[model samples]
Target: MTAFQQQLLDVNGITLSIYSAGPDSGRPVWLLHGFPECWYSWRSQMTALAEAGYRVYAPEMRGYGDSSAPEDVAAYQILTLCADIQGAMDALGHTDVCMIGHDWGAPVAWHLGLLEPERVSVLGAMSVPFGGRPKRPAIDIMREANVGRFNYIVYFQEPGVAEAELNADIERSMRLLIGGNSDVFLHPKPADAQFLAGLDVPTTYPEWCNEQDFAVYLRTLNKHGFHGPLNWYRNFEVNWQSTEFLAGRQVLQPTLFLLGEDDPVGKLEAYTVKKMGELVPRLESHVLSECGHWIQNERAGRVNELLLEFLGRHYPRAGIV
Candidate 1:
């Protein structure tokens, strides 16, 4: 743990702040964190992975933490996100590595399998499942699904609106979003619901989430703001347009999909499971009971165990280059 080192690496012209541990000579594992979270999201799982004979590198994606954030909405497109990881591979001098993503990061890993199939030895995604591209533009589809304010994706479509409201009270907003400060939407959401609005900020965070973890996100988001994170939603249409060539394509890499049974992702689990078997060719699935969207941190012990077992089963130490 104390051996972990934080440094900056230039990938595709974007400088990313990356935290890495374990032997440099060991097989590399790219640990990616999703929206509203930074590299710290992977903190709890690092030690276990490292001990299991893995070299883990968790990078604060562009627009999060001290990483370079491009202002152009086009910059955050899925292709660019894939390129970021490809560029990181190039910079690190590795032809490919096991790609593991949580939440928003899951899409990045899944798309990397599509865009650069050879660069990923295996794919492990959490919370979000890849059921292939949406039939139409995601935002348009989502907006139509819930024309009311309940659509957070649509709410994020507008740039400054979410930033101002979210940043006004960073601590409170984070407490609700990740810290479990309040579960306003614990009940079925209203027709017009806002993620941050009407949520109470509690003095304590969730049992799994600690003040130290909350503080890390608070400091990072307070500095960079939510514009970059929300930009991911803004690229829905463009990402679809760019990846149209991959309409029928499936992930050829061995895939591992894990999620919290209680996570909204469960709604699509059946479809995703079927899709994976159809397109992925090699797939494994697991759903931890009583868990939520934050699967990695929520169940760090099991995640590490699953991760090591998967890696050892797929790319054993003796086989690693």
Candidate 2:
């Protein structure tokens, strides 16, 4: 396996810790991790892609791990997040890339498809699906739809509220969230309930994540706290309003969408997948049965297989220098 290299890059006015592998001359494949996860989340995929002769660049995205966590809530806006990756690509001297993202990282990857259609040669996303810009802000829609219920996104709107609860017990928080059932996010809770209320931390780590893996996440979040990550949820409205020009835009790149059968996010986004054919003209999609939200980790071998096959078809590593 190619040894991974780590570096801190100053880009988009902040620093990002990037973990890369494979030959520098191999075609670049940028992996963007989602909320509460660092570059380490892509460990399995990075190794697989690197071994296949693809340069894999996975960054501890802004607001997580060793990456700079800007205090301003507005700083976590989608445009800025996408800009960070864009700037990184520029600094690394890669003009074209195979971009892939998971969870919150999915939105950034989707928007990058819109923001830099030509540069993102092919796109892959897990957990989240892009349905194009909505007519109204997502916060307002979520607010109304989840009225009289504890929607995590709405609960995260008020500054410092969710942060306090999540930061209080970093380990417990990570355990409950990473190993918790997806139904918790789908099922209605009392409007005033806290994020971690009623959820029990698992005594044992999920089969997908071992003690060493859990340790990395626990230590990373403990160091930075949940403030920066929660701030990501706070910027829904800002992202919606700022991307008005992208209202009808479609991701022209060859795209792949993967979701777990049991992922509540997938259930919530079933409509998007149905209509995705219109937005993503050349698209391939799959749903792994019995899997949950952490698709890559919970189903790492399968996820890597799918990703490598997709890249092999559309972004093959045979020719690039």
Candidate 3:
């Protein structure tokens, strides 16, 4: 595998730390990591794709890692995040590249289809499913649905509330969140719901994210407080308002969607599967067994296989340098 290259890129008025590898001439494939995760989250897949002869670009995202984290919650809106991707593309002078996103990144990728389907060659998402826009804002709906329950997204609505809980203990938060923190309110079971279940979140850490891997996340988040990451969840309504017109818009890109059987987030909305297929006309769905929310980590090998197959099908790596 080629050694990873690190650089700070100026994009969308923010300086982003991007890690990339593989041949510069190889077909470009950008990988996006979700909340609480850095480009390192795609370390395994980066090597896999890079070795498969595709240039891989993974950024720490605006709010995470060495990247710039703006204080305003509005700065973290969906359109801004999408601009970051486009800005990176313009900076890199590349277009028609495939995007693979996990967790929060999934929605960003799906939104790209709505925002600029022509900009993307294809799309792949994990953990989160793309259902059409809601009748009302999502946070409003989540508050009512998870009433007296431990819904993390709803818990994240209030400012400083989740930050206080998460910033108080970074390491513990990383451990539980990675493996579903089955005991936390983030888990579907109401019996385990607590005010801030992320507080008791030290029990389960997925194999891929061991003590060493988690240390990287802890140190990174410690450098940049939870304010920026938490701000991502804080912008639910703003993002809803920005892209309100695109509501119920169908994603025409050829897409591949993957999920873990044990992911509680997958069960949050019952309409994801039906809606995903309906919106993403050309969709290939796969669910890995014994996996949790972290599908790319838990099932790295299989995930790479699927990605290579899909990318190879659309953008053949036969003649590219």
Residue pairs clashing, model 2: none
- Cα lDDT of model 2 by residue, 38-153, tens digit: 88889999999999989999999888888999899999999999999999989988888999999999999999989998789899999898799988888898899988888888
User: Where's the lowest-lDDT run of ten residues in candidate 1?
Assistant: 179-188
Please, what are the lDDT tens digits per residue for candidate 3 over residues 32-96?
88987888889888998889888899988888988999989899998898899888988888767
Most TM-score-accurate candidate: 2
Tell me the lDDT of model 2 at 26.
86
- Report the Cα lDDT for candidate 2: 0.89
Cα deviation of 270 in candidate 1 (Å)? 5.6
Off by over 4 Å in 3: 185-205, 318-321
lDDT of each: 0.80, 0.89, 0.81
Question: Over 4 Å off in model 2, which ranges?
Answer: none
Pairs clashing in candidate 1?
none
lDDT of 3 at 44: 87
Better structure of 1 and 3 per lDDT: 3
Any runs in candidate 1 off by more than 4 Å, and if so which? Answer: 181-193, 268-270
Tens digit of per-residue lDDT, candidate 1, span 1-321:
437789898888788888998877778888889988988888877777777777888998878989987877788998888788888888888776888998889999998878777768888898877878778887787677775446566677877888888878888878778866214333347655566776667777877778777788888888788888889879888988888888988888888889887776555355665566677778888889878878888888898888888888886645555
TM-score against native, each model: 0.94, 0.98, 0.93
